[model samples]
Target: MAAENRAFVGSIVVAGAILVAGSPFLMGFLQKWESGKARVLVVYADPLAGGLPTVCNGLTRHVTSTPIIVGERWTDEQCDAEERSAVVAVQKRLAPCFKRPPSQMVFDMATSHAWNLGPAATCGSGAMTAWNRGQWTLGCQRIARGDDGTLVWSYTCKTVGGQRQCTFVQGLANRRADEAQTCGEVL
Candidate 1:
């Protein structure tokens, strides 16, 4: 009995020592946002917004104890967490729909688009079909293709107070350009 007790105590000490040795790296990892490097994709997905029922990548489910007000705000940390969750969820949702493996950047780009649209829209999209066929550049074009069925950045213009105003659609032209180039695609 005494021998067994000693062995058990020795095992505990070894285990404790290992934990002590690993604590610094473990703590650093714990302090990091859970998404790791992919969190950058989430940040890119969630645009800065100053409104409640806020749209982050077009996913709007943030709710607090009380009703979310117009000025209900989120810290960078909070927003990161939320966006990371959305990216992960949508990624999982769309994962099985991919016909072929994608590079990490391409997958991140897909996650960004899926966030802006819904998972259903993304998964069932022609973009998904094209990507599944390993037609990456074509898929990317479909992903960024505007409502006019063209790969062009479009904006809505309105006449307010008899003055014409055009709102660039989230600077989407830049996003499309970035994604296309990353995928070695041109439109």
Candidate 2:
């Protein structure tokens, strides 16, 4: 099983290393959002927003064959392998949603959005609708902001005046903006 896992990672590394028409590698670009820790798990939760247990590369689940535990440790290689595997799985799950083939940049951005949000949300998003129509710029813009110009998928629920309301998070907004820039990059 160890040998098989290593072999699988080897293949992913090869595929990940190949440049797609000067586009950034998905894993490397994704690192800007999902940082890696070599020797420990990075677990965090938003006080108001609520979050899940996350490991290397923002992974919440399927980090390993065994279920992940809080405060568990992992090697750099382990983290890298699992991260690549997760990225591949996300890509595959999101593949059928696009009616037209996307450029590498667009595809990577879409995958990044889905990585933060779930695949179900991404599939039903207006961005997905625009992409399905081959409207790349519109889709990219929509990834960060809605038609009303408010940030999307960057909100976390917070209690305001004793009522829970969704509020924008600067960090998540920043990530969305960066993704939008990358997706909007002119080839």
Q: What is the lDDT of candidate 2?
A: 0.68
lDDT of 2 by residue, 39-108 (tens): 2354554243255556666776633354655666666666666766677777667767877777777877
lDDT against the true structure, per candidate, is 0.47, 0.68
RMSD of each: 14.3, 5.9
What lDDT score goes with residue 164 in model 2?
Answer: 91
Name model 1 segments beyond 4 Å from true. Answer: 1-52, 55-59, 62-68, 146-149, 152-170, 185-187
Error (Å) of candidate 2 at residue 20 is 6.7
The best candidate in terms of TM-score: 2
Query: How many residue pairs clash in model 1?
Result: 0
Q: What is the lDDT of residue 6 in candidate 1?
A: 15
For 1-187, candidate 1 gives per-residue lDDT tens digits of 1222112111111211211211222212212322343222222223323232442223355321223333445444554445445444555665666767665445555655555445677788766778788787777776667446665433445679999986667555555555555544322
